[model samples]
Target: MENYPKSINASSLNDWYNSEKEDPVLIDVREHSELEIACFPKEFLHIPISKVTSTYVEELFAGLFEREIVVACHAGIRSYNFCQWSLDNNIVSEIWNLEEGIDGWSRYIDPSIPRY
Candidate 1:
């Protein structure tokens, strides 16, 4: 892919999500057990990284257009990798990795979100 993809920190993402006319789709790629400790307050789709398959992705994104997808994980590494994978497969026009992941959100955006 020609594009290197992009990333958004918790602060910028929070602001963009609230100020923008269109809401970006926040997806948590962390394992289910990790969510029990802390979770993003906003509405998001939970899709474990392990279960991500071409078929599942096609079905999940079916009928969706011009969607802004933001992938998140524990510390951002996994999410960043996912972003690369998305781009490699040409899954979406735009995909952003949640830099520092939920841990960043907990540290920078909301302290209420427990950090493991």
Candidate 2:
């Protein structure tokens, strides 16, 4: 099994995105309605936590196992749970949870990303 990072703070994520040669996929697990309140850059893939079901996982995320995935939610709880489940189910080995979630991102990296 591949050893994956468990979590990443917003500032480090910001720095990684800015300087890293390989672009990591940022997956937002917040609901569609929650997105209207605050949103990250367009580069983030909006895949609500609810949609990560078995069928959806098989259909949409099967090929993402080898990719670097950073999952984010409002306060990090949901994303953390998702990443844990993904790891347990062998969905993705390179998955990481955004420490403190978008709320942290708003406070540490970009204040423009509203906090709810």
Best by TM-score: 1
lDDT of 1: 0.87
Q: Which candidate is the best by lDDT?
A: 1
The alpha-carbon lDDT assigned to residue 85 of candidate 2 equals: 79
- RMSD (Cα, Å) for all candidates, in order, is 1.2, 2.1
Query: Candidate 2, clashing residue pairs?
Result: none
Question: Model 2 over residues 1-116: C-alpha lDDT tens digits?
Answer: 54545889998888888885676788899999999999987488888887788667656676665677889999999998888877777676658899989899999988988889
User: What are the lDDT scores of the predictions, listed in order?
Assistant: 0.87, 0.82
The regions of model 1 sitting more than 4 angstroms off are none
RMSD of 2: 2.1
TM-score of each: 0.93, 0.88
List runs of model 2 lying over 4 Å from the truth: 1-5
